[model samples]
Target chain A: MSAQTATIRGWGFLAPAVLWTLAFFIVPFVVMGAMSLATLDGRTLVWGLSLDNYRELAGQAYLARAIAVSLEITLTVTLVSVLLAYPLAWIIAYRVPPRWQRLVLLLAILPFWTSYVVRSYAWLLVLARDGVVNQTLMGLGLIAEPLTLANTRFATVTGFVHFFVMLLTLTIYANLVQLSPNYRKAAMDLGANAFQTFRHVILPLTLPGIMTGAFLTFVLCIGDYITPQILGGNTELTVPQVIMVQLGRRADFPLAAALAIVLMGIVTLAYLAMARWLRLDRL
Target chain B: MPWAYALALFGFIYLPVATLVLFSFQNGSLPVPPFNGPSLRWYGDVLGDDRLVEALLNSLMVALGSSAIAVALGFSAAYALARHVLPASALWRALLIAPLTVSYLIVGLGLLIVVQRLGLGLSLWTAGIGHVVINLPIAFAIIYASMGAQQQNAERAARDLGADEARVVLLVTVPMLAPAILAAFFLSVTLSWDEFIIAFLLTRFDVTLPVEIWSMLRSGLSPRLNAIGSLVFLVSVSAVLLLELTVFRKRRR
Candidate 1:
């Protein structure tokens, strides 16, 4: 085929996807960006360059608090999930029998197939006042009364951590299994103890993978609505919850768009910070 | 010691699900502790509820429909980029994959704005569109990664033997890449099926299972939620195991 024909055919194949993305994804994003700068004049949208929504986000104590709360919860979830999942991935990678490793990993992430909304609701029940955690504690004489485990930041964090631990385990285990046994052998030959080898050799090699997983955890956790809404019990609002309220109750599209833009900004900052280690295409 | 830790971690991971499934068989209304008779009452209730059943069917349609569109678009894009030399191909690839980085909430909210502005009412079709937007990048990336020199050679052979480009793609390229394509389609379906925020934001009266489940949760807590959740879990895991047994296992041999 001629170069012209080849290019034309290539574009013919590409146009459907490109047009769909541009129309639905790119166009909507640009419109949302514009909507963020527009104002609501008594329920009528006034479209123009105005920063009123952003200013409102800064001035309102609750709105400002939502941003702080989202950051705190997301950071905590990311750190805790990484700390927890890394050890699990290591155990599964090095400790499990080769024949059983796949099964073990699959079992680890099996809960992920459950409905996401249902999973959050499941957490709510598990942590309720008369829930299993409390019942088990009382059964074992660990406490006199049930602790307030549900509808709190702890519940929200627990729910987020549960989902992310599974995700990070998968990503980190993939990274771990890719390393040849030769690396560990070489480190041991250099008179490195197991801990020393892990610290100096394995740790650095897997840092990129860890970062990638942690970044994913951060993005998903920060943007998540269902976990916090169901598990949080309105104790505190995350940014997504706040955005939902804006759209659902107030019909405040401009403000919600502004909040979404803020969310995009935060995710962008995270991406930049972890850009060196991220293998987004690999996912 | 690592085994003990693994056991404990696995316990933590499975506790909620075990509770959810266990209470789904509870004879009582609440899905909490104080175990009662092992019963199928809640499961019966969930299946009998018309709204929940309707939402389940809606979720299935959206999952299958959106995944089909996403896979088709993704496959063509992957094929074009893999085969032909388009100018600024890297930029095009980046654009196609860009949505993977954005949050689902943001994507849904963005589309909500455009849909409302354009006076287009929200429905399952709109929700399907949103699902396609999110799943397309995933399908594209997976298929693109699996496109190899072996398929390229086969396509060339087909072309050399007096076959047209379309025949080469349909007969040679697709069959060779069937595993990747199927994997991408199934993955897309799995994601679209369980998606919450996008469906919640995009749809109106006709909602998906996750959205319906959310409302069920809001109205009150019951074992009914547990029953439906367990059913969804059962369906998803069955699909996954079937794929593992049939597609992946066959490929490995």
Candidate 2:
């Protein structure tokens, strides 16, 4: 085939994907950006260059609170999931027998196959007043009554942490298994204690993995509607929830678009912060 | 100590799923504790519920349809980018993969706006479109990463033998990348099958399983919900095990 023909064939092959991305991904995103700047006049959408939605974000306490609530919940989930997952990933990667490692890892992430919405609902049931957790606690004589565990920020955090710890463990474990033993041996030979060796040698090497997992947890957790919506009990709403309310209940697409853009902005900020360490391609 | 911690974390992870499955057999109406005698009544009810069954079929259709499109597009893009010396391949790859970074809610919301503005009614097709949008990047990534010089040399040889491009792709290139393509397709199916936000946003009456389940949850608690949740969990777990025993195990070997 001539080079010209090959080029034409290449374009032919590439056109579909390129057009799909441009039409669905790029065009929708551009429209969403424009929608964010447009305002709703009563119920009808007024298309214009206005910052009313954003201005409303600052002026409205409830809306501003959603941002704070989302940020707080996301940060907490990221930190706790990382701290909890690191040790688990460490134990699995180093302590588990090689033949059993795959099984162990598989078991760790097995529940990830379940419906994401159902998993959140399961947490709701488990954390319910008459649910397994409170029943168990009372059965053990740890409490006189069931603590209000469900329908709170705590429940939301627990649900988020449950999902993310499994995720972070996988990422952190991948980082752990890739480390050459020579690094640890070299550190031990240099009179470094075990703790010092880990702190100096292993920790830095795995920071990338931890950060990558944490960033993912932040993005997914912050953007998620199901976990917070089901468990949060509408006492407070996350950004995604608020965005959904805008779209579902009010049909305020412009405001919803603005909220989505804010969400996109937060994720972009996170990506920028973790760009140095993110090995998403590795995933 | 590590064993104890590992066991504890394992229990924590499995706690909800175990509870979900257990309550699925509850004879009572509520899914709470005080497990009643083992009963398949709720399972029977779930199986008989026309809407839930319809939603299940809808979910399957969307999952399979969207994943097929995603895999086809992803494979073609990967093949072209890998085989041809295209200009600015990196830029093209980046554009294709850009959706991976964006949130699903964002993607769904974006499409929802476009669809609404175009005065198109929401349906399973719109939701499937959203699924394709999200799954495409993932499919592309997996297929693109697996495209290596082995396929390249094989395709070159096919071309040298005077095989046309289509024949070369169908016979040689596709078979060479079968594992990656299959993996991508399966992964996309699994994702689209359980995906909620996009489907919830994009679909109206002919909703997928997740949206139906969401509505079910809103209508009050029931073991029927448990039965349905358990059913989905079982199906998914079975698929995972099947993949593990076959495709993943073969790949590892």
Interface RMSD of each: 0.7, 0.8
On the 0 to 100 scale, the lDDT of residue B12 in model 2 is 94
Candidate 1 lDDT over A111-144, as tens digits, reads: 9888899899889889999999999999999999
lDDT (Cα, tens digit) per residue for candidate 2, span A1-283: 8999998899888888888989989999999999999998888888899999999988999999999999999999999999999999999998999899989999999998879889989998999999999998999999998999988999999999999999999999999999998999999999999899999999999888898889889989999999999998899999999998998789889888999999989999989988998887777
Which residue pairs show collisions in model 1?
A: none
Deviation from native of the Cα of residue B15 in model 1, angstroms: 0.1
Stretches of model 2 off by over 4 angstroms after superposition: none
Query: lDDT at B70 for candidate 1?
Result: 99
**Clash pairs (backbone) in predicted model 2:** none
State how far residue B208 of model 1 sits from its true place (Å): 0.8
Instruction: Give one digit per residue, the lDDT tens place, for model 1 in B46-145.
Output: 8899999999999999999999999999999999999999999998899999999899999999999999998999999999999999999999998899
Chain B TM-scores, listed for every candidate in order, come to 0.98, 0.98
Q: Each model's TM-score, in the order given?
A: 0.98, 0.98
